[model samples]
Target chain A: MKVRVHVSLKNGVLDPQGRAIHHALEGLGFDGVNDVRAGRLIELDVADTIADEALDEMCRKLLANMVIENYRIEKVAA
Target chain B: MPFTAAVITFPGSNCDRDMAVAIEEISGGTVHRVWHGDAALPDGLDLIALPGGFSYGDYLRSGAMAARSPVMQAVVEQAGRGVPVLGVCNGFQVLTEAGLLPGALMRNAGIRFVCRDVKLKVENASSLFTSAYLPGQTITIPVAHHDGNYYADAETLDRLEGEGRVAFRYLEACNGSQRDIAGVLNEKGNVLGMMPHPERMIEPAHGGSDGRKLFESVLHGLNALA
Candidate 1:
């Protein structure tokens, strides 16, 4: 099994990196840019029998800092 | 038994030597060197210091990986027993990631790796780390980090203010930290995490010795307790 974890800063939290990228885009003459926020995607390979509860625990423990970020797990067939 | 302290060194830590030197100079006591992979801390430590640097390569997040290292488990345990721990710069990030402190340090608001002497106000001078400074006194300490912006929920921020947990505050815009907080103390006031490097400012050749008083104050507090 393959799992991808998407971790993003929660709303109301400042994303300075995202803002910098937004500025760079505007400087390059890019248009149609709204607010930009950045996040990370972590891919993992695991046994198919791995339960969602176990995956959630991983996110809570190491994959994401719950204080400022949120995470979602997507399971894909290998 | 005079002011024994330990400085935990992760693979990329660059300031452990400086921290050790400061402690040795002020405390005139044994300074134990501990590695991140080590599982045990030395017995009867008066202080534990997490020095500044890109620990664990700052991979996942600043200090995030190092926070989960084997030694931090023991560090956390000792901290629960009221052991005084000081985390400077990246060390501060580790403490927050390790759940020993509140809030997180994010990228600088201007998206720059700020490295310079920043003026800081002694917010809580009574802390073991800041007793040498008068309340509201301004001191200069150098801050060098990219992810130094401090963030916490409003309630937690209010509580830290109310409880005098804010040990130091930036005197001017340096890293865009919330409430200009540069250092914070734990609930029991035994653990302190600060983005600025006091060790860097200890020697007169570093241009100022304002930071020396902090280490001196720690030793002074310990002696007073003894």
Candidate 2:
């Protein structure tokens, strides 16, 4: 199985990188771009027997810092 | 009893030598250099230091990978048992990722790498690390990092303030840290994590020696407890 994790700063948390990109977009003459928040994508290759609980534990333990980030896991059948 | 300290060096840890030198010069103590791959810490360590540097090149996140390294497991265990731990800069990030400290370090609100001398106010002078400073005294220390802005929920922040767990606060707006928090201590007061490099300020030639008292306090505090 292959899993994908999308990790992003939690809502209401200040996203400096996102704000910088937003500024850059305006500098480039782009319009209507209200906001841009940056995030990361992590893909993992795991055995079929890997349980959902294990993946949750991975996110809670290491993949995502629960303090300011939230992680969403998606599994794709191989 | 002689002060025994260990400085854990992860890949890309540039400040390990500085941290070790600071501990040695200040306390005249034995400094042990431990590698991240080690499975266990040396027996009977009086202090464990996580120094500044872009550990693992700040991959994924600053100190994220290093916090999960093999030696960190032992570190977390030892810290739980009340062994004094001091984490500086990237080390502070690791402590948060390791769950030894609260909050997270995000990109600076200015979105630039801040590297210069900044004023800091000693908030808690009674902890093992800050006992040498007078409460509310302002000291000059240099901060160098991109992701040093601290963040925590309102409740936790309020509690940290109420309990005097906040060790240091930025006197000026250097980072967008919540409540200007630059340094904090663990619930047990044995672990300290701060963004500024106190080790860098031990010598007068470095501009100011305000940071020296932090190390001195910890050294004396530990010895006094012995």
Which candidate wins on DockQ?
1
TM-score of chain A of each: 0.97, 0.94
* Clash pairs for candidate 2: none
- RMSD, candidate 1, Å: 0.8
- Please give, for residues B1-226, the per-residue lDDT of candidate 1 as tens digits: 5679999999899999999999998788999999999999999999999999999899998999999999999999999998899999999999999999999999999998999999999989999988989999999999999999999999999999999999999989988889999999999999999999999998889999999988888888888898
lDDT of 1 by residue, A41-71 (tens): 9999998888999999999999999999999
Query: TM-score of model 1 relative to the true fold?
Result: 0.99
Report lDDT (CA) for all predictions.
0.94, 0.95
Q: Give the runs in model 1 whose Cα sits over 4 Å from its true position.
A: none
Docking class of 2: high
What shift in Å separates residue B219 of candidate 1 from its native position after superposition? 0.9
Candidate 1 yields a Cα-based lDDT of: 0.94
Q: Kindly give the stretch of ten consecutive residues in candidate 1 chain B with the minimal lDDT sum.
A: B214-223
Clash count per candidate: 0, 0
In order of appearance, the predictions have TM-scores of 0.99, 0.97
Clashes of 1: 0
